[model samples]
Target: MEPAADMETASASTSTSASASASASASASASASASASATAAVGAMMDGRLLQENALSWPEVQEICKELEHLYRKDAQKDAARVRALARKRKEISAACQEKKNTAQQQLNQLLGNVREWEQQSNTAKARRDELAKKLQELEALKREMVAQLERVRVDEQSSKESLERLLDTYETARQEALKFQLEHRNEIDRAKHFMSLYAAVTGIKWDFSGDSIAGEIHIPRTQEIVPFEIDSTQSNDFETANALWAKIDAAFDALDNNDEL
Candidate 1:
């Protein structure tokens, strides 16, 4: 049993190795067949004629030789032309790229300059705004002060006008009172003057007592003598009457002198 098992294992291992070897041989054979077929087709193409000679004969061998030489020359010329064209295109593309890069760089520089100029203008505008605001504030404060001063002046003017009106009223009242007092005393002054005139007239005449019978004869004095004489009636009655009349006359004279002086 151990021998049979060993024999079977060995058989299986031999079968696997043989299968791998067979696959490799088949692959090599396929490659060789493909190579041979390609070579046969090439030989057939090489044997063909691309153009005709002077005669109707095929001239396959000679035509093939001539065509091969023409194809080789044509291929070399085309290769040289393609190399020149490629070189020209490369130069053009490089130049175009360089121009684009220069234009982009110039545009970037201009944009940066413009941005800086804009920032400077903004700063100037801000400064101007601040200055204007300060000026406006000052103007507002001045206006408020002016208004306050105007109010104060108006109040002072009103007070002065009121005081002037009161003074005028007081003066008018004093004048009216003085006029009323003068009117009330005018009639009394006129009556006193009339009585004085009558008394002076009666006294100026000479006495007529001789017509009436009295126990004693009465003597008459001259006007000049009686003018300076005193009556010999009762002492109190005669003295009092004469003194009262003199006082009234003196007062009237004094009032007239005062009026003249004024």
Candidate 2:
């Protein structure tokens, strides 16, 4: 019975050793598969990061996804559908992320474009304002010049008017003086005419005046003789002689008159 017990113990120990070895082999296999799955997950994470970092085109991203699907199918046959589905989900996630990034980039581009346009418009407005300011300055200068010129013209006109008025006053004075002289001269001439007519009618002699002297020739009545005589009224000291000569003429004229009456 002891020998049988020893054999039974040996068989039990052998079965236990076989079971321990099989268990160790299965655990190692499982560990390797877990490590491979972990490595593949890490690789997929790195590939996803790479895809995210690079600005790849859509076709390039699609080709990379197909390659990852093929690799996943070869690595995990039993979980092929799940791996394919995960790859498809990753592709969709990448596409969504890429689309979101593209939308953000487009929005940034539009904002930049708007800013540029606004800057351009601001520059244009500034230029227009500067041009208007320049024109206003020129207009102000022109107005000042015009005002100055008008003042000068006014001054010139005032000066000319004053001069013309002075000339008119001078001409008026000259004309008045000329008219007074003419009137005095005409009165002198009329007095001289009246004296000459009185002398001729009263003395019965044709007389002519030379300055202040009188000269005439007279015919004696009933005689064929004429007497010529001259008198100088300008000689004041010879007035007595002039009176004697006039008395003699009167006597001769009286004798002639008596003879004519007889």
Pick by lDDT: which candidate is best?
Answer: 2
RMSD of each: 29.0, 27.7
TM-score of every prediction relative to native: 0.39, 0.39
For model 1, the run of ten residues with the poorest summed lDDT: 214-223
Clashes of each: 0, 0
Give the poorly placed runs of model 1, Cα more than 4 Å off.
1-80, 178-262
* Candidate 1 local lDDT, 138-237, one digit each (tens): 9999999999999999999999999989999998998898789779977887888777466555434233344432112122223132222233334457
Q: What does candidate 2's lDDT look like per residue over 128-206, in tens digits?
A: 9999999999999999999999999999999999999999999999999989987979888798889867765555555
The superposed Cα distance between candidate 2 and the true structure at residue 94, in angstroms, equals 3.1
lDDT of 1 at 175: 89
> What value does the lDDT take at residue 57 in candidate 2?
70
